[model samples]
Target: MQQLLDHVAALKGEFDREVFTDSYWAIRDEYDLGAADEQFWPPVFQRAGIESDPTLVASAAAKDAELASTIAREPHQLLLEIADAGVPLGILSNAPHRMAQSVRESDWASVFAHLVFSSEHGLMKPDRAIYDLAASHFSDVEPSTIHFFDDRERNIVGAHAAGWHGHLWRSVDQARFELRSLGILTKR
Candidate 1:
């Protein structure tokens, strides 16, 4: 998944002001502002003009959909293929809830068994709580049996720490090969 991670990292640098603004607000709410240091909010919130209620902060995310759709890559097809093989799929992302909605609307939601959005969970990845939440869903399966694919190194590292095998997503080809090597897919 190096390719995916690289691509996302590149996109982070290219993120427009609107996208960053929306992401900042979304993240602020996901972590629960009350527990966060006061220093974290003002600069970001001042730039975005975020208010006390998170819903308004969340609404700032509407600007992201346009930019995100433009960056669509090939890995989602691999995700769908893996899901079609009857391996349960779950999405654990730090994106706002609307981001998941956009993915669902993009004809990909059917592939996912569960979507653990940070906004919905009030916890972001790199945090053990969110990773545990995803793990909890597969109580019948050993943590090692559930493979997680994420485009961020931090998230992948966190998943590993939580006892779930993770694929640090880069490219579709690399991810497919990893799954095959893991015996999740058979060679034709």
Candidate 2:
């Protein structure tokens, strides 16, 4: 990632990380709400004084997309176990289109009955609508019986507001313990 950034900096004469960060945050919600990677990267590059060359932007976007594939590995086995236990599983995430696509193509994708990406839904975490949207997929289950785990407190609060059981995710073990306590997972 740094290599890509460095290459952009070389081409543009100057690149400021803070500028890039600010630019990204400014449009992150829009990006997560289905904006194309092609749209997301140019502003970020321009803000950082990096040349917004299409190929460079694509390279950066591809690198960013790879993050979803790498980060979700820890929960793969646990998700598979839950699926094997006959529990319906879903993923609700605030992500750009590329990252969402990457996750859908991942090996663990099969374990989930639904993949709810804000990029496709136009609603991101902490939004009541997004929570409701996720819950809608589990129509047969009561809202309280739906368990949601998120690393962000605001998102957890939103889940709770939606009448679903929400757990703050600290680690895979913590999630397992919480799910077991909620009767969503049996002791193994």
| Winning candidate number (lDDT) | 2
Candidate 1 local lDDT, 86-154, one digit each (tens): 888877777555565576566666677777777676788889888899878877878877788888898
Q: Model 2 segments beyond 4 Å from truth? A: 1-14
**What TM-score would candidate 1 get against the native?**
0.67
Model 2, 115-139: lDDT tens digits are 8999998889999999888888888
Cα deviation of 73, candidate 1, in Å: 6.7
Residue 14, model 2: Cα distance from true site in angstroms: 8.0
Q: Go through the candidates in order and give each one's C-alpha lDDT.
A: 0.63, 0.83
